[model samples]
Target: MNSTGKESRHVNIHIASPVEEVYSYASDPANLPEWALGLGGSIENVDGQWVAESSSMGRVVVTFSPENDLGVLDHDVTLPSGETVHNPVRVIADGAGSDVVFTLRRRPGMSDSDFRRDADMVAADLARLKALTEPGQGPR
Candidate 1:
């Protein structure tokens, strides 16, 4: 939740893959561009800070949670306007596969349509992740 105290919308997708495989791929900030198209088209490390060339917001710095054994993929995106948004994401073991969840927060003063658009974007990203992680689907 931000300072406005609004609850975030939860978007999730289940992939037919091992938790380790999903976590290993999604937890890496470098691979975000491949799946998280809403954030940016591409990402790179600049001066030790992760940066992405976002078509929506131009070049911006992105920071992800430290690499850990846990399936935490939370990240903070800093826009060029100096505002930061916290994105909470996680991949959990689900039987023989994995369940990936992402919390989509509505920015303060965002319109209803914009909020819906954000949710749609998250759904698409998760679908992309699912495709990229499924067996025999993603790059080998």
Candidate 2:
């Protein structure tokens, strides 16, 4: 935890793809289910809002940042209880490839095991992203 009493972990992965390509792929909500399994197995747009019906936290709404060249894929997930969790994600250029990072924050009153679980989930999602974006692995 930092001096502000906020506990966070930066879970990231290196993808063997250009930053632009990775950002384009990761920024689209339609492609989320293909890699972001931690969010859900499927997602659909409902009246301009992305809704994931089978997410781990049950049905939830996801709001992504506006499209930009900064590789910012930040999104807010509104839980069933109406609480919104802001997830900070980024795809940065790393030579010929890109480095995708997800900052997982520990919620208030959360247990140690829960924080670890969230970190593991984020790590797995990044790995999936790497698999899907890397050359000769899966679809571009």
Candidate 3:
């Protein structure tokens, strides 16, 4: 479901996999580069924090939700300029499959077009996650 609200919007995708399987892969910050293209191309650990080199944001650190059995995959990305953005993600069971939801919050002073672009990027990322976690399928 997509919604326009006081502060945020969301993009979600359904995957043909169990919730545990989907959560296991998506919860790992090291795997962010494999799916979250808008974030960066690579992720590394530096001083116990995950860092990535973003072409747009330069070098940055990311703080991911702690390891847990629940399907929460929220995280925070701290930009080189010290600005941090919160990303709320969840993987929930849908009958026999799973649904991955990503919440994209609109930053202050962001234009409409840029917010739309961010949503588009998140949709693409979810598609990538679906392809990655679904059985009997190959990534596009």
lDDT of 2 by residue, 107-126 (tens): 77777887888899889989
Q: Where in model 1 is the C-alpha error above 4 Å?
A: 1-5
* Of candidates 3 and 1, the better by TM-score: 1
After the best TM-score superposition of candidate 2, give how far the Cα of residue 10 lies from its true spot, in angstroms.
0.3
lDDT of each: 0.88, 0.90, 0.87
Cand. 2 Cα-lDDT: 0.90
TM-scores across all candidates? 0.93, 0.94, 0.92
- Model 1's TM-score against the true structure: 0.93
- Provide the clash count, candidate 3: 0
Q: By summed lDDT, which 10 consecutive residues of candidate 1 come out lowest?
A: 1-10
Model 3: CA > 4 A from native: 1-5
Each model's Cα RMSD: 2.3, 2.1, 3.4
* Residue range 34-122, candidate 3, lDDT tens digits: 98888888999988999998887789888999988779999899998799988999998999999998999988777788889889999
TM-score of 3: 0.92
- For candidate 1, the per-residue lDDT at 102 reads 92
Task: State residue 41's C-alpha deviation in candidate 1, in Å.
Answer: 0.9
